[model samples]
Target: MRAARPRRRFLGLTATMVSAALSAILAFTVGTAAPAAAATRTVNDIGPVVSSLELNKGYEISRDCGFTGVPQANVIGVLWLFCDTAVSPTGQRVWGTTAGTAQAFTAPSQSLFGDFTDASGNNVVQFIPNPSGFSCGGTLAAWASGIASIPTSSPNPLLIIPYVVMCLNGTNTRPLALRIVDYDYTTNTFSNDSPVGGTGIFTGNPLADNRILGSPVVYNGSLYFYTGLCTSSAFGDCSAGTAQVAKVTLGSTPFAAYNASNQSGGHRWLDPRNYTFSTLAATSGGFTPITPASFDVHRYPAFSGSPFVAIEQDDIGGNITVFSSSSPTGPFTPRFTAAVPCNSTTGDGGLCRAYIGHPESSTSSKLMLSYFQPSDSHGNGHVRTAWIPWS
Candidate 1:
């Protein structure tokens, strides 16, 4: 194993001050504002896009690991990926090649490294809870931005692959860390924690640094990650822009170490601000990565209306650009650009203002989002869910 980096520390701001700043950003970014009294939800009949699974209906699920009445507590992000079964259709959840009860997936006990703010003005962190007496080997880096599930094959063996990517200390460099966790639902035990090996997998071609941004998704048997570079650009590196939609297949050969040059789709990297990168979708030949034209905007994208990739980008004053694509990588077109539903003049207080967390589509066509609602600021932040059912 390579020598691990030193533990990162938060400086300049006290925990309270840092927490406050995060809460403010969340308020403006994902927080909720009071909609007009006559407000009604926009319904779309986004026609057939993907396989019609009955799982698309939305249901409110628990966020933030069920910590009620706690300030700065809410689920901020969620991802629903594909899984295959290795077992016969025997009405059983095949867990292992040796076969047993299926392993129930669990969230980590430790929360995100940085402080997050919600619309209602509450600062929060999503953490994985450590069991009473388990000595896990890995360490989570500070201010880590995104979380994704590593795609896996073999439904009969019931494998769990969870990966957490964290940016570098005081920079946006991600030395991508991966963990292959095996959960035994019957015994409720977890093992098989390993660091994703370094820079060897991309064929020693040097995977772009500081490109880890946005949530990750899996399609066509390969795990795809979206690169942001927004944070770096914010720090004044305008020349450093390389947005990427990259993928690697599920195998035991250490994906992070796989040769970047050996992969298909050509590591489609671009400028996050200059060009738009669509999420990866499976194609007949391989995977397709879509790019949008200038004067078009797509931001905070999530799977919506089943099979359709949806994004809402802020346009010129009072306008928001919303786009949808049936194919993950696509010749995508625009849906509409409309006024934001929430008012942003005087600023909404509390964590409730941050209503937009990470948005995602479950394999069953259901849409899930982690954002702060009206009650989130004073320990009332909520992780809410909604659905767009199309005939």
Candidate 2:
């Protein structure tokens, strides 16, 4: 479940609410260390707390681009931040920003170095034009949702990003489309590549209507992704949401050849012979329910014995749930919950959203997390970083 772009503009909340929210947040320090599996699991607030990144204040960091679960990628040595942006709409409304541009960032330190604009002072990310002049009238704009680096046998690897798009006037976003782009580590420039196949087709499960969320995990030489089914024009309600696993073989181009006329293509780099799709099952053979707004799968590099960990937000972004499994398709055990405290206060205007985790920055002991709160008028929206303790 992604956060909706407000259809109309929202005015900042009152100063009183902001003060109360800050007070509540300061009352709790980062919680105690994570206990063993046998002990009770509880939310802990731990940190060397820093100020929130004010992304909405300047012209470069405008609108919904960095508002949701902004995914990250480490190309060569630099950490690249990808999100969708548009000119903020006029008037009062809730969620529905016109997403037209893709923005990239380079973070020299833990914080970002510059604006989302490029050297030309323009937003580098733009949408693919609609040849047929379909429903929405304008170009189909995409927002970065998942990004992964494919390790080839050669020294240079390929960068893959999966994003969801919306027609200009469309009510909801489409499933997802894959783009194979190039990044220069020395110059810190990104080359916009044409989408691999067509829109809404995933390599392993081409026919399945699934909207991919979170970062794809590469384990045992295979890439694993999590998806939510799309029933209608909008995304699946996922009330009885289940986790589905899609695998892409590493080393080669996993996408099929592009067919412009019919919009049909094969998974060129994916090994069709080895690729498989399966639903995650419980120990009792029933389906496990997990509706994630934005989900991420992380495998500990330092601890060889640790399980593959998964973190996801509930439908409303109110609570973050953690699941652990020996394998991607398995009986995942729900371990704990990190309650989003900002949602409880009136200051946030109940607009807080749980963000995704960056495995590239995580270690065996802690995982980095960021959340968005739109009620904070001081910035475009208040983005706060926190550490989730893992034992």
Candidate 3:
């Protein structure tokens, strides 16, 4: 998780005022109106060229812990955080990277610090330190599974806001909980902002049974969350349940409540309410079907001039497909496919999962992506990176 340097705030004139000034300047210079150019939509298929890097060696996994790196959130231009899992220790931990440099060939250095934990060193949900109560009173556990940072254009870039998905225990009855936590870069600390929508569980909510995946995409002051429902037969396989996408306003109080009645694909807002959930629709105005697997969505920085990007994972096949969409919820256009390198001969069960990391914080034309290979008799689980070309 590479931390980003602070960026300059834009306090210029409003868009309306700038437009008026531009009009006046144009009139004085040309003395006549110029024809406006029509917008054109051109889709490109020149996908990114993937390659292996040495950065994986920087992540140190303890023998007792079995720490496996899972890329969780990218605080655009700020830092990268991994929602890592420890098998032997049987807990979750977060790891961070130093400031990221625009290096195309080298991997960024990372460290394991700045994570939420209890006095005894057990992993606990960092967001809600003093929770009202846990579903079960035994040893409680939590992880910052997924996170998305607020845009720099907001009140403060230094005030990093991330939505955290947590699970009490690895059971069907105890579904994952979504909550928000504030991370201050200046002070290097976390503040529990409580669960979104007042209560952690939605009761009869459609997404109650599903797990929120990847980092949320913040667009126009709202955060969009992608979710998938998994089956009981096979763990981590979500292909059996219905897939959905939901959204909530950034600063809404008590969070926003979901409206089950108004279930449309586009902007299904229930007025004065704070949030809404909708089934993804295809380009032909039909349901957008998806397989049960992990996926990620992100908003490219303005400079990139790219649409919202999504990387859908195929864990069984060990491949990842990239898609682009003009809006968060849409008929996403598939662009390219990349294979995850695996060494089957070593036989640690040979598994690979491609996880898309933060793209907004990378170079203008490149995004950071990572894949993890679980440890075999040879070594511990390792994380590797590939620079995806966006432009």
Q: Which candidate tops lDDT?
A: 2
Best by TM-score: 2
Q: Write the per-residue lDDT of candidate 2 for residues 1-391, one digit (tens) a residue.
A: 1233433111000000011001000000111223123223343333211212224433323333232112233333423343333222322222222221122221112543333333554333342222222244433544454455655443444454444443433454332233333433334444544334443233221212332333555677666655433122223122444444444444344332211122123221112232212111111121244554455555555434656666655544446667666775545676666665433223322355535554555566665555554543333444444556665
lDDT of 3 by residue, 257-363 (tens): 22111222222322122232311211112113333355566666632455776665544455555666677665565555655553322232234443554554346
Candidate 3 residue 289 C-alpha distance from true site, Å: 4.6
Tell me the TM-score of each prediction against the true structure: 0.39, 0.60, 0.56
Off by over 4 Å in 3: 1-59, 62-77, 85-132, 151-176, 195-207, 211-214, 229-242, 252-289, 302-304, 343-350, 376-379
TM-score of 2: 0.60
Better of 1 and 2 by lDDT: 2
Lowest summed lDDT over 10 consecutive residues: which window, candidate 3?
A: 8-17
- Cα lDDT of candidate 3 equals 0.36
Root-mean-square deviation of every model:
16.8, 12.3, 14.1
- For candidate 1, the 10 contiguous residues with the lowest summed lDDT are 10-19
The predicted structure with the larger lDDT, 2 or 3, is: 2
Ranking by lDDT: 2, 3, 1
